[model samples]
Target chain A: MTRSLTTVESRLRKQKPDSGQIPFGRTFTDHMFVMDYEESKGWHEPRIVPYEPLTLDPAAMIFHYGQTVFEGLKAYRTDDGRVLLFRPEKNFERLNLSSERLSIPPIDEEEVMDYLKKLIDLERDWVPEFEGTSLYIRPFIIATEPSLAVAPSKMYKFMIILSPVGPYFSGGIRPVTINVEEEFTRAVKGGTGMAKTAGNYSSGYQAQEKASKEGNADVLWLDGVEKRYIEEVGSMNIFFKIDGEIVTPALSGSILRGITRTSILELLKEWGWTVNERRISIEELYQYYEEGKLEEAFGAGTAAVISPVGEFNWLGKKMVVNNHEIGPVAQKLYDTVTGIQRGRKEDDYGWTVEI
Target chain B: MTRSLTTVESRLRKQKPDSGQIPFGRTFTDHMFVMDYEESKGWHEPRIVPYEPLTLDPAAMIFHYGQTVFEGLKAYRTDDGRVLLFRPEKNFERLNLSSERLSIPPIDEEEVMDYLKKLIDLERDWVPEFEGTSLYIRPFIIATEPSLAVAPSKMYKFMIILSPVGPYFSGGIRPVTINVEEEFTRAVKGGTGMAKTAGNYSSGYQAQEKASKEGNADVLWLDGVEKRYIEEVGSMNIFFKIDGEIVTPALSGSILRGITRTSILELLKEWGWTVNERRISIEELYQYYEEGKLEEAFGAGTAAVISPVGEFNWLGKKMVVNNHEIGPVAQKLYDTVTGIQRGRKEDDYGWTVEI
Candidate 1:
């Protein structure tokens, strides 16, 4: 069943930031979408209200047990002023998967999509039309039940908020240096790695902080069991081009199935490129690098369509890929993905939807 | 530096629940302790305010990243009108340890202790005086910075709330049946397992739900890597009395450093009992059971104090322990620990703090 949207305008509208200098997730739109779930009633009272603080009991389960999940996507404003969303349905589908894994009651995907579109329509002005700017959407579910017990919460709150964000690379698309994480593991087999849950992100903070302190851009996590297999880059799916072939880690249940990563794979296959998804151990990668077969390395996610990896430091040995610069493959993939997202390229895959 | 406490009384105090019918964490006291932390100001404005809903931005990091930690302890009201706190310092110490791991700022132990005592004194009437009832204390820290970036938060809120809880075993210490979790592993080395963080608890919800559906009290987690070595239980530390010796999992980086687990080990040592803190595999446990050397099994935690395990079902095979009854060691340990906590027995270890 569809729920009608309720709107409450804010008395004081926040000043819009300059599209050229907009930082990620710091500024929000005037309104947000909210819905509540209870044991007796399903998700109800869908509404778009003025952006404000949420009042919760101190004993809320989200603060203690962390029964929470979230999804990230963006609304793009084309040069011709049409607002488009890139595979928004995929986000909601993943949100449902996360909810089930966390023992939370799932919401109606179509109904939530309607609510999301309504929210974006109301805040359409917040979408930026700059070349590298867009309106980032964050949808999350949290356990709101006021209990300290270690069990599934009986109450939940699902919300969506919008923030104007500038380009990930302000100057240019510069390759980044990564450190191989040997001490800290993000997720193991049969863990919550595949689910876009809060715990999976928090578990990587230590390693990320350590890598940042060591002058690295981010950490490249290894498998939890053997610490040999390459899992993923920090918050993004990783890809390597070795011997003129593109390879990415398979969905081993411990790596997030990124939407951008999926699109990249589809695009690669369409371009008649050899692409493989399987276990890629660190030793194998080093061997390829030693043989000068490792041509390019990059990370893919919604935030940065493609972030090239220039250097990798594993256990004190440094290996530079593609002479510490972006390779042809990474550049082409970036251009193709961004072109389709911004309506500059043909929508052969029908991945973007006009709202 | 110590901060002065400010008090704001509630206009409408809630009706106190009957101690005999108290449910864990469902009901809270009239007041709560609150403190705020900023990167520049550190922790400030320590106060005891009326228990009310906390207002937070919907994009708070705790909701999306799970950057939160919590500690559980209790305040017991002795028969002679004295409130006793068992090893409260230990909880705060562990809280600091958790903070370090999660990249959150640490709080002053002495100052927070002072704040906790003030809070308990204000709500001392809420402490249950029944034989198996006590005022449960939950102190937690959550990232409050309204940012969507996957990084440590700059703002935080530390809170302590009180809940009157009845005995964990309301049916007079009946042994519980446990299911050995093989498919869903809990935590692995180099993970956030040793810390009292929210992610660790949330990650176990799936396994716990599966066990509950299959008619079990809780799931007994194994090491995340091999899934063979025994780890902690759902919310407690597992212990076994096999071949006349007490055994528990060593402090592998993936198991929590439980406060109750420490006390139990100390008591066992003081009583001249053999206690081994090392890896104990499921195969070794089953071997002991087959040889009739498995004497008892129990779980240790703040809430339960001590809970005996009647049976363990591993891979469709069920093994009964101590003839499905509490062994002498488990009984004695429970009585001794509870005695020390409630001030019924002599406090030789200075574990109790008076407020």
Candidate 2:
């Protein structure tokens, strides 16, 4: 940890003071941690440098071929004046999982954790004091090899950059309307669906925009082949409550296994709630709603810890939740998680990492 | 065009050679064409700029959310000493179509073509003067807004970069092995399957790697839900020849409508070959292959004008195409397209765009 701090300090530079006024992702911290990988060297040249533009060949595979994967988490400043990361190890694990699918080299967990801690420590001032705002940390790996051939990149770069962000949902933990997209699938099984890769967001943008134009908040993607099973809502994993039992779409190889999603399941079980991960077809959910057994629905992700769904418009049919408000179950889950994240609740799950 | 040329010249910079080893996308030409879009300004500030690294905030939606789309085309220096684009308009049209599906702002054709001409004219020296090599042009758009919110970006960047590329199929126009991916689907119907977005590529990489490791050149992705019908072959559109008729998967809202694919169909029809755009399931293909009616299969795209497939391993069964060598029909198609591109044949379709 001492060596890591020293390395981070050496790479640190003066950050612009006016960054506070900038919007999320508009500005970066002074220093960034980088590691380069080559087939011969494996992973080498771990260094911290000033955050600047990446000098990549115009034909870099990431730009043209889209061989890139990234992860999003944050460093929060607790009331005790300590910087903490809520389950960052989960993010690290997910990043590697994405890396393996993208054919990028894996990083050592110990070294990566050390580097992340060091970076967060150096950029501690960037963490906002707002209740919902914090310093957003992005760790991404890209194929830096300059080859037009359609093969995995031989050279790669792993980079970490920090940005101060406000709340993920501008309107707070309010419910969101999702347009259940029967037109497009986010990812298919046997594909990189379960991986947190950049391509998923790009592919879902159209549906998202369509949903927004049609007076919805996000696009709810279904299985590509059948177009009936609810897979995900854009970037978040979805959970449905039917008859007091919480059901989430199983990690069916076609949906992202969100970290917050898994945590919520664990928390639900701890709170004595029946939580099951299984195939959740749209027909069953619609039927559950018809039978008045559907209690609530919500989405889970790193950014939006727990976003309750107000209603879902599927194929011209509007299926509203019982009251079009945040369900009590969802509110409790949000409070419990946010409490743990902000250090108000007991950290029994060992999810928080004090920086 | 005059105003665009004048504006473009202001941004042009002299090319700095990076050693003489032309690696794909590693080096760029002197100038890059760029334009911006906003709700107020629409598409404005069209200019050609020095090839440089984009200064993106770490949280730029493209970096985290993958709100990006791209098109690939090429500029060929024909034997007749003319710089011509192989069906540039088709790429332009397809790009906008992809943009519409991806919720990206669509650039006006006149504006884009004007900028493309300016860049090509400035980078004429970089265009390769070889039989099988040309300057590959990559046009892409990314969401550039600084907000962390998950909505359509208010601002966008449209960029065109050039790279000198050699033959796409290094081993010549020979058939390659493709593994039938039973578990993963590249894009799903009612999803962004037809749109050329980054998510689709990243999602397909894992299956592609698995296919290669399993002794196949590429993965033949099936439809998402059923995983039975054949879809596109990653970057290229899949095609089949059976009983002297050409057949391809119809654009059923899930398959990318490749320009080269449509071009080939037109060419086949011009040559009096029966061409059909309809759903042909994998089982039907195998049954046809077993009956000796399936003569050839190929993939069409800008990179590889046409790539012949020699064999397919579908559901534990290995099936071979007629005559492991390039089939007669594929050879003729390839000869026709490349011949037209290299100036060996006349551009009867008016597909070539002269710079």
| Residue range B28-115, candidate 2, lDDT tens digits | 6777887878889888778877776676554556666667778889998887688988878777788888888767788787768878
The list of candidate 2 runs beyond 4 A from truth reads A1-27, A168-172, B7-28, B170-172
| lDDT (tens digit, per residue) of candidate 1 on B1-355 | 5687899988888888765678889999999999999999999999999999999999999999999888999999887889999999999999999888898999999999999998999898898888889999999999999998889999999999999999887865778999999988778888888889887887788888889989999989999998899999898999999898999999998888889999999999999999999999999999999999999999999989999999999999999998899989889999999999888999999999999
Most TM-score-accurate candidate: 1
lDDT for B34 in candidate 1 is 95
The residue pairs found clashing in candidate 1 are none
> Of all true interface contacts, what fraction is found in model 1?
0.80
Give the winner by lDDT: 1
- Count clashing residue pairs per candidate: 0, 9
Measured with C-alpha atoms, the lDDT of residue B11 in candidate 1 is 86
DockQ of each: 0.85, 0.49
lDDT of 2 at A316: 92
Give the top-scoring candidate (DockQ): 1
Given candidate 1, what's the lDDT at residue B225?
90
RMSD after CA superposition, every candidate: 1.0, 3.5
Interface RMSD of each: 0.8, 2.6
